[model samples]
Target: MTRTLVDPYSVPDELRPYLQEVVQRTHALCGSDLVSVIAVGSVALGDYRHGRSDVDVTVVVDGTAPGPVVPELAAALAHPALPCPAAGLELVVYDRNFTARPSGEAGYLLDINTGPLLPERASVDPSESPAFWYVIDRSVALQAGRVLYGRPAREVIAEPARADVLTALRASVREHSSGEGHLADNRVLNGCRSVQFCRTGRWQAKRRAAEAVAASEERFRPLLRAALHSYERPSRTAATTLPTTDVHTFLAWVAERVDESSDADRRG
Candidate 1:
């Protein structure tokens, strides 16, 4: 039942209501302006964790909505009022061009970041955000996004390909490795997934990627396990066992792997 609307259903009964609300609200706000509503990230990958993972969604419109419309939609869909059953609903609105193509810059109409795990914020300015996460999210959306409304995902979204992903991975690893206020568990698991992506050029769930890497890279098993343990738990302090020093090392290694992959990709 969880996988009905899309492949490999991950949404449980508890999450269905909240997920439905997101679709309904977006339709209500955007109306005929809405081009597509695609579900991305953990939920699309069948790795969604209730109270842990975000129900990431992307809304594609023909063009920019009325300025006030975006703000209203953001307020309408954000936490407390709508009550995201999962950790939160991360819904981003993009024009058809942005949704259909990959850009190296942060170009979005609206970003609603809400949930208990995250600070509540509905950002309309793309200049205030980084481009890497958006690019990565777009790539995932291109490959795996499930259409919640409007046109099919493939018909509307364009592929960002492997090269774009590796570049984005490099940028992300660099930031998480040195940037302040990043989650340690996220760094480790993301490292595992990035390394796997570098090696295989395939995208997958963080838990799946970590498991695959742990099976092959014996040296990082303990760290991966710690990260996986923390990711599975809903508590904020779940990463207590995740070593800070090792996480930096892992990110560095992942950065190097991304570099190698990037170089190889360029050569080929």
Candidate 2:
């Protein structure tokens, strides 16, 4: 199916009416079959940025379809007049069976039970796999989406706590950073660091310090530097492995330092 491009911000006036029409059309196509159409991703989270996002919508049918509906949905969204702004639309089709299984990709689970038609399920319990972070972090932002049937957007994503999501995010960042030669590893780490600061009002120059350390080395300097920064102060001991406790503690320290820096910034 051809993808539809959409402007992340300021949905075209034409687009709103088109979206309503599409939803109505989609509903009629399904016709009283128990199905749910939900919006998920950046637009759902109220965090969309223009020129850098797309629309993610999921269709959950009561029973498995003979074939994937993603292609069809894409085609519908890509209609010449409709023409989504970015790389068209991203559509996932699921049957009840598909929704029952835990999502293999971490943060991608839609949490259809409680969030909006398109809800952002952000909780990341440590017990959950690092894969969760990979999904959420790498998720393409959805500028806007609607539910064709069943449940409002807020009700679907409301159960998961922000803290749980944050924890999952942290684990994801650590996992990516630990993997060697991943250029985007630093981005994950920085994202986690930013979250930590926001949650606890603390900042660690760890990302910057780690970057410096990595740059100085000829090889995987960033990874090595991250490990060093994760260690407790004065001793400056480095380890071949990254223990979660040590990483968590280091994050805490970073947070404390950030708070201090913020205070200093205010005074200055």
Note the clash tally of each candidate: 2, 34
Off by over 4 Å in 2: 1-15, 68-71, 78-82, 86-88, 97-148, 153-268
lDDT of 1 at 147: 70
Candidate 2, RMSD to the unseen true structure: 13.4
lDDT of each: 0.78, 0.41
Candidate 2 has an lDDT of 0.41
Give all TM-scores, in the order shown: 0.91, 0.41
Q: In candidate 1, what are the lDDT values of residues 1-268, reduced to their tens digit?
A: 1222342244566776777677777777777887887888887676777766778888889988888898889888878888877766788888887766756766888988997677888888999988778888777777777777778777877767677777789888988897476678877777877887787766789999999988998888899888888888875555465677888877887888899989988899
- Look at candidate 2 and tell me the lDDT of residue 37: 59
Off by over 4 Å in 1: 1-10
TM-score of model 2 vs. true structure = 0.41
